[model samples]
Target: MAYSLDDLLNPQVSKVTRSTDNLIITTYGARGQGKTPVATKMEKPFYFAFGKSGLSGINNVDFQPVNSWSDFKSLVKLFSNKKNYEQLHEKYHTLVLDEMEILYKYCEQYVASTEGVRKIKEGNGGYGLWGDLKDEWENEIMKIIGSGFCVMFILHACADDTGKIMPVGDLKRMLPIILNHSDIIGYVRGNGSDPETGKPIHSSLMLSDTDEYFARTRNEYFVPYIEDYTAENLVNAYYDALDRQEKAEGTSTVTKEEGDKMYEKQRITFDELMGKVAECIEKMCNAKRDEEVVDIVEKTLGKGGKVSQCTAKQYEAVEVILNDLEEALA
Candidate 1:
């Protein structure tokens, strides 16, 4: 059925809210400079060590030893599985891709082997192949993100010919893609000594396109510079910033009647919301395995519960989950 102009212009169409809980943090530093230490401090971190740099010094952290690009891809698939995601949600809060520079090299090698080419260049059509590989990597990353895990990438910093510290890879093509998806980029530095203790002081500088390095934070509360960098410290800083922003927005003083009126103005009806939910579920089921789809429904709406029986709040939750799923599939 076609809608009239009034229905089409209805303001109560239901808007989506963004979650600030998940973070994408990228850190770079020289070897033995406490890059792994920062990651080790995160809540229940699972490390993917690609540089053969085993978590020798780090204790009691779960890690997967990745040898090749194929291994990493398989690992991504494993994590994307619905059953594993449920288990992982209970066991881990963060996923760390250690030494992303090595991962990039492996991606290059994988492209070369698959395309029967020796180098990635535009002339030999390897550039297009590299783009495809990058897309694959991005899809896996987004899936992990959508699964509600904090994604962290550790890299070894490289100095360009101009002595500017940058992520070690195809900066022109690949770095922008990585940066665009990242919420924070930090450059590690540890040269100064503590004034009182006479011990070395290590710090990570969150950048903003400086002449010396590339760093930034989407969170305004971040000082754009940190004298000390620890996983707990950064996470706390983020939430504190979020809290400040929330407070700055001020609390609503509307009464129940006023609030109800406002909500009525913005809220989509139960039937309208269910229609969108059904369409989203159909798309999700088509993109995922049947068991995964069933698991998601059960988790969100209870065992054997149909979408039609969901309450308005439950429908909102399902909508968010389905949106994440569709984005991951995309």
Candidate 2:
């Protein structure tokens, strides 16, 4: 996992690799399909509120209210420190309110040359506090990511012409955290047919598991799967490389002693190293769980059992295989 200067020069990761500092997830949809609901479901374990009011109709969620941006920043710091948010999620995760488009807008404003960065201030459409929003957003995202828990960024998308790409939308002027960060790009679509005909009309999850899939569908590696004439079989494809690394290397062991060993070898910040160790403790610590899956796979294959394809999307077979591979990695 050696990182060369050249690799850093360009702001991209290797073919199928993922780093801890950049675990980003974004979900989009037209209407219904519970895109937010599913996202909220995932964050139900740890939902922090910024305003003083109740979540009102928000279900399957745990709410912690914050007062200001500074408080939010402080929360991010504590989580990264691994001191706070330790109990929120056994693994440490945070939910930022409407973070996606904000970061996108932040990026756009940053590129426009903000007021604070330019100083002097031009309130009349001139650079202002928002001008420096991008730099601040980018720095904060890294902070949250560094802090243990996984982050969930909610976003809104619309069609924008005059650019490259379709189902296109401006990152709301929020662009900083997005320009160089965000590991996963997800879109939410709903089944569009007849209710009597068993058509789904809620938000569906269309995920980008690999660059190849992205290129094939949108002719652009990052374009979301929201265009017309698409299928209801939108599958959530994510990079499995992270889990695979642990499985591929038999060297992975789980005792505290082994944790320390892996920590030193990983050489990321100590906290990040420890976080992985914690997750490992939950999985590898139990020998039965680790061995059970491989045992099942072997027995199934021995019986001539073939993997089935039930992925809603077209090429779902590919999705099924990748899922199997991810299981192996796990």
- Best by TM-score, which number? 1
Give lDDT per model, in order: 0.69, 0.45
What TM-score would candidate 1 get against the native? 0.66
Per-residue lDDT tens digits for candidate 2, residues 110-192, read 44454334332443365454435545666776776555454656555454443322223335334435433455556555567
Q: Which candidate is the best by lDDT?
A: 1
TM-score for model 2?
0.48
Q: RMSD, each candidate, Å?
A: 12.2, 20.6
Q: Write the per-residue lDDT of candidate 1 for residues 1-330, one digit (tens) a residue.
A: 223366767745332122332567888877777788888788888899886564876788888888888888888877767678668767887888887777777877776677777665532553456566667666655666554567887888888999988877676544665677788888887756779999877766555668888777876656666667777777767666656655766532333334334444355676776776677667767766656666666776678866666676675765655554454445
Cα distance off (Å), candidate 2, residue 64:
2.8
Worst 10 residues of 2 by lDDT: 211-220
